[model samples]
Target: MKVLLTYTSMTGRNEKIANYLADYLKEKGADVDLEEIIDTDAFGLTDYDAVIVESYTYHDGEVPDEAQDFYEDLADVDLERTKFAVLGSSSKKHIHFGRAVDYFTMQLNSSNGEQVSDSVKIDQDPDEDDFKRVRDLGDRVLKSLK
Candidate 1:
């Protein structure tokens, strides 16, 4: 399946995690398209069989401005046939930790996209083990496609 992974990272932590995921998926033989949400002009959920939407926790449970554009770009895309999962990279100590994941999941589900896996919430200061878990998330999503 083709997997599109997009994310925004204010402090670069989420970007690192997104890259790790893309690498893992590629190594596993899945077709992967990884891009920073800020760098992409447009995207449609229908273009890929499955997608991984990710972001770092931003202000008070709000989606970052960069990702908002991409999400809005999805407006013209038919999502009912798409499967996706969300990943949130945040500091557990932050008041809004994991809020990005919650918001993204809600948006995707409300639009009729299938949720491929439970949202994966990574605490701040992710380590190698956390990286592995995040990579496994990609594997799990791929399995769901089968």
Candidate 2:
């Protein structure tokens, strides 16, 4: 399967998670395209069979500035046949932890994408348990495709 994994990270935590997930998916025999969400204009969701977006929650659970354009562009895109999953990182101190994942889930649904798995949220860096959860998420996405 072709899988696109994109992320926006401020302190590199989300990027690490994205890379880990990419490796996990690749081990499961998927063709993975891992990217940093710096240029949303060049991203085309239709080209991939499945997509996973990883982001770190900005202030007050908002999308990072770098990814905002991509978030907005989702409304104009057609994702009828693509499956999506969202992963987000945030500080546990925040009241709205992992809000970016929720926002992205809404956008994915509005864009007609099939959400294959529940969203994953991690604090700062991922631990062993977090990695396991991420792996299970990949498995779920793969299973959904079949």
Candidate 3:
């Protein structure tokens, strides 16, 4: 399956999670296109069998500035047949932990993408359990494509 994995990582944790998940999906035989969210085209998601988004929440629970264009663009895209999932690594210290993950998940659903897994939100750093959840998210997305 062709999967598009787009992410934004200011502190590297989300980038690491995105890479790990991309590798996990690749090992399972998926054709994965890993890109930075700013470099990705929201209108192009429909070209993939599955799409995954990873991000970091910013001040007051906003999508990072670098990814704002893509986030807003998502509202206009139609993903009726795209299977999707969202995950983020943010500080649990923040009251709105991983809110960007929530925003993306809701927007993708609103765009009509078939959600393949529940969104994942990891605090500051990922531990063993967090990695497992990321893998599980990847597994669900890949499975839904079959």
lDDT of 1 at 133: 78
Write candidate 2's Cα lDDT for 7-97 as tens digits: 9999988888888899999999999999888754424898888999888888987998999889998999889758989997788999889
Question: In model 1, which residue pairs have backbone atoms overlapping below 3 Å?
Answer: none
Per-candidate local distance difference test: 0.81, 0.88, 0.94
Candidate closest to the true structure, highest TM-score: 3
Q: Give the candidate order by descending TM-score.
A: 3, 2, 1
Candidate 3 per-residue lDDT, tens place, 92-126, comes to 89999999999999999999989989999998889
TM-score on alpha carbons, each prediction = 0.89, 0.95, 0.98
Ranking by lDDT: 3, 2, 1
- lDDT score, candidate 1: 0.81
* Pairs clashing within candidate 3: none
In model 2, which residue pairs have backbone atoms overlapping below 3 Å?
A: none
RMSD of 1: 1.8
lDDT of 1 by residue, 1-146 (tens): 79889888888788888888888888888899998877764446678888888887677877888788876766555586588899978877878889878888877876778987889888876888887778778878889878
